[model samples]
Target chain A: MAEAREPAIRTRGLNLWYGDFQALFDVDLDIARGRVTSLIGPSGCGKSTFLRSVNRIIERLDYVRTSGSIEVMGQDVLASDVALTQLRREVGMVFQRPNPLPISVRRNVLFAHRLHNPHGQSRAEEDELVERVLREVLLWDQVKDRLDSLATGLSLEEQQKLCIARLLPVKPSVLLMDEPCSALDPEATSAVEELIWELRGDYSILIVTHNMAQARRASDECIFMLLGKVVEHAPTGDMFVTPTHSETADYIEGRYG
Target chain B: MASPGGDRSGPDHLGREWWWDKIAQVLLFGGGISAIVFIIAIFVFIAQQGLGYALVDLDLATYFTSPEWRPTSEPEPVFGALALIVGTASVTGLAMLVSVPFSIGAAIFIGEFATGRTREILKVLVELLAAIPSVVWGFIGLMVMSPLLMDVFDVSVGVSVLNAGLILGLMAAPIMTTIAEDALKAVPDGFREAAEAMGATRWQVIRQVVLPSAKNGLVAAVLLGVGRGFGETMAVLMASGHSINMPTSPLDQVRALTATIAAELGETARGSDHYRVLFSIGILLFLVTFIINLLADMFVRGKKTAR
Candidate 1:
């Protein structure tokens, strides 16, 4: 787990602002390939801001502005010539609350695939792709018989898993999740944490969590941030045991953020 | 429980608050039910005025089937309204054809693409366009569209189906745009965010995700526009030539049902068959519009429950 590897996502000199309020300041990180990294910070500490800037989804708000260099899978994602659609295809995202489209499960799963491949494919091939992703997320059996049903009908936990599953069909190398389990119950939270753990080493997962225990157990590397600045980046155990910064120790010990 | 003042304010000001609350409840209830009361009253009045004459005296078959609408004929009036129905149908149909695409496009542009100030300005402009009186629209149709149609299509009559339809379509667009934009807006922002994150382009998100989710509301928008077209009197009466002819072509002169009632109702004697027939036309318009409004309301409700 501690092996030195090439980085999948490297952000250097990253700074972001939302209409004059700076949310992220000089965020620099080199997240290793095929590892689950957790970002832990108090609310409005720029943890989610850092995650969103990776895929540039933060740009959806016109007032948001950034001065940064973000590279995903060794490609300079922030380059002017880069197509956002292609960049997003390579780097998928899961939201805080499961926001599945108001469409059938099958269609939601195939949405990206169809967008990239506008020409038709065989029905059997689509079914196979759908099954493969759902199986990867350990959701195939629960949703096996109801592939055509609306995705919104599924439970929040199932919907969260489906959100992850939908991204796999597009073969995104990096996955960014922002508070994926915050909306779930304690049981469902652990269940989804287990799914995230199983997804490790296959996709580079960058997850933001408010649950300190989830960060301790479910992640390989941990990042602790405060006031839009990264305080510490270490293996989860080391960060929890002997953090390099006072803010990190206080946050980890249930003291002040 | 120990606080007697908390239990009542009955002691405060000699229960003035309680009396006011009771008065408010009664007033609010009356105000709310007044709409229903008025609608029922109007329907009953319309029925009383027209139902007997339409059922017993008028020739139902001829009124529906024949195109001859000579209500003031010497010995015996024909009372056929087939031509007027066709006239209204043709104009409204053409108007729909022209308006639906434009309204949807405007809605997409405003709801999806335009940002803060531009979006607000466009909305204000749409309302401004809708604010122009129908009579003023009629004037534009008669003066502007009429000549333009005659010159472009090599037709003698300017106030034909083409002229009236163009005017009505323009008239109906602002309302359709407003409602369609609302439908588009009702689609949650989460859906757009999820789709866009999956690399769906702006247009793709609108067409595949937003439009499907809001289809019921969009259809309701179009239906309301159709109802507006059906009930419109001044514009169609002024723009559409009030000739009693079954319009066979876009260039052919026609008279709408609304235009006929508006044009002839004033001249007819109080209890004459012609006056009674106009009231009957009112009933038909009422029923058509009532159905359209009901369907639109149902569609809006369907959207609410589906979500």
Candidate 2:
């Protein structure tokens, strides 16, 4: 059993609201550490909201309200004195769209590291870090010669890779990807899926995706959410073959989204 | 017309939308080209009015170097413009110093910090500030700002370089803030979200990502403000004291080129050297504003292609 190991993220009785509208119900989940777990559901099912709740990025909206607890790497992030920057450093995120800074590729990779280490590392150390992270994202060979060029100039796939690369320098314990490849083409999607797979075991990744096939192929564990509640959490093969709930089965069979 | 099963004999249409569309196209084209036509017409008119004096008998040496501008003396009327040029430059330079910080700060607050009713209210107030007439601003400079400056700096005269600069700076700030806010708004919110997600503090995100991302547009905003300050006449005329002195300090009184033409053009007889020289000043003002505007436009376009 994996009982001896601590979970990467633990949510207990978590509820969320946006002004008058409640978006998430009292949901509880324990995402196993260092695994690729995909949250799959229909539109407005709150899968992405649940993912955002863990890192508390949605708090940027003034009207958003949350209760209960979300602990990232065993720290209760919802506590007032908890420094968000520190939490964000531990739990990095990639958005639905590849949102790389309008800066050089080399700087993009080093953005988070610079945030954490204000005094900064020397040029050789930074160069090594950039190379190491870019290589980890499988993007170094293509962008090696153009490190100083704008990251925005890269293709969507490369941009997405760069976005992921930018997060790695901070050595985040968890990476939450909200449909990271939805904007990418099929070829790019598979390429990014492979890259995501390559990143597994090194970092705990909770990915929210709409594609059933991608969920089946890419993730080790799968969770099905409906109406802001977790419907099922099982191994990817078992869930696809024999879903625990009819909603999960219907969702997988394309009966209705 | 042809039957469904039969071959067509000639090209034909059932709809009557063709002629209306043609008329609309002609009308829209005329509307689109009116700006270019008007600009060219104005330039030609200014050139025609000033060409005789500027080309034939302008005393190029005295016109540029000498500060004496006695255009109504009995024996000999000097036509030097060095003082007027410096006056305009100094007023506008001081104005930029006062306006840039206020404009950028207000823009950042409106675009990045303020929300809900506060944002809407601030935006409306800024726009109202811009809509206030230039003459009214001149009145404020003459009646209020000048006296205030005199009290603050312990100067004998109320209207000086400082007074005009303060008034013009306030006058120019609304437009500058509006444009700078637009520039900041143009930077996609995604960049802010991306930076914030990277453990960057709010200030860090703005300083490192948002400002740099919107740098071109912000520069364009400042340049446009400079253009606004350059062509402004009424406010500069009222606040700049209309003195012909070459200023060595902020307290010294000076006169702007725009003020000179606005003030002396009516008094001078038609076709006189003074009249033609006023038109020459108009030509210079036109050229300076045109170049500043062109540069601003290019910077705005740079932001577009960067994405």
C-alpha DockQ of every model: 0.88, 0.87
User: Over all chains combined, what TM-score does candidate 2 have?
Assistant: 0.96
Q: What is the C-alpha lDDT profile of model 1 across B1-307, one tens digit per residue?
A: 4454455434454454678899999999999999999999999998888889999998999999999988889898899999999999999999999999999999999999999999999999999998999999999999999989889998887998888898999999999999999999999999999999999899999999999999999999999999999998899988888798988898888899999998998999998999999999999999999999999999999998887
Q: Any runs in candidate 1 off by more than 4 Å, and if so which? A: A1-4, B1-14
Stretches of candidate 2 exceeding 4 Å from the true structure: B1-19
lDDT of each: 0.92, 0.93
Which is the leading candidate under DockQ? 1
Candidate 2 RMSD to the real structure? 2.6
State which candidate has the highest lDDT: 2
Which candidate has the highest TM-score of all? Answer: 1
lDDT of 2 by residue, A1-257 (tens): 26678889988999999898888898888888989999999999999999887778898999999998988888999999999999999999999999999999999999999999999889999999999999999999999999999999999999999999999999999999999999999999999999999999999999999999999999989999998889999989999999989999999999999
User: By summed lDDT, which 10 consecutive residues of candidate 2 chain A come out lowest?
Assistant: A1-10
Interface RMSD for each predicted structure: 0.6, 0.6
Docking class of 1: high
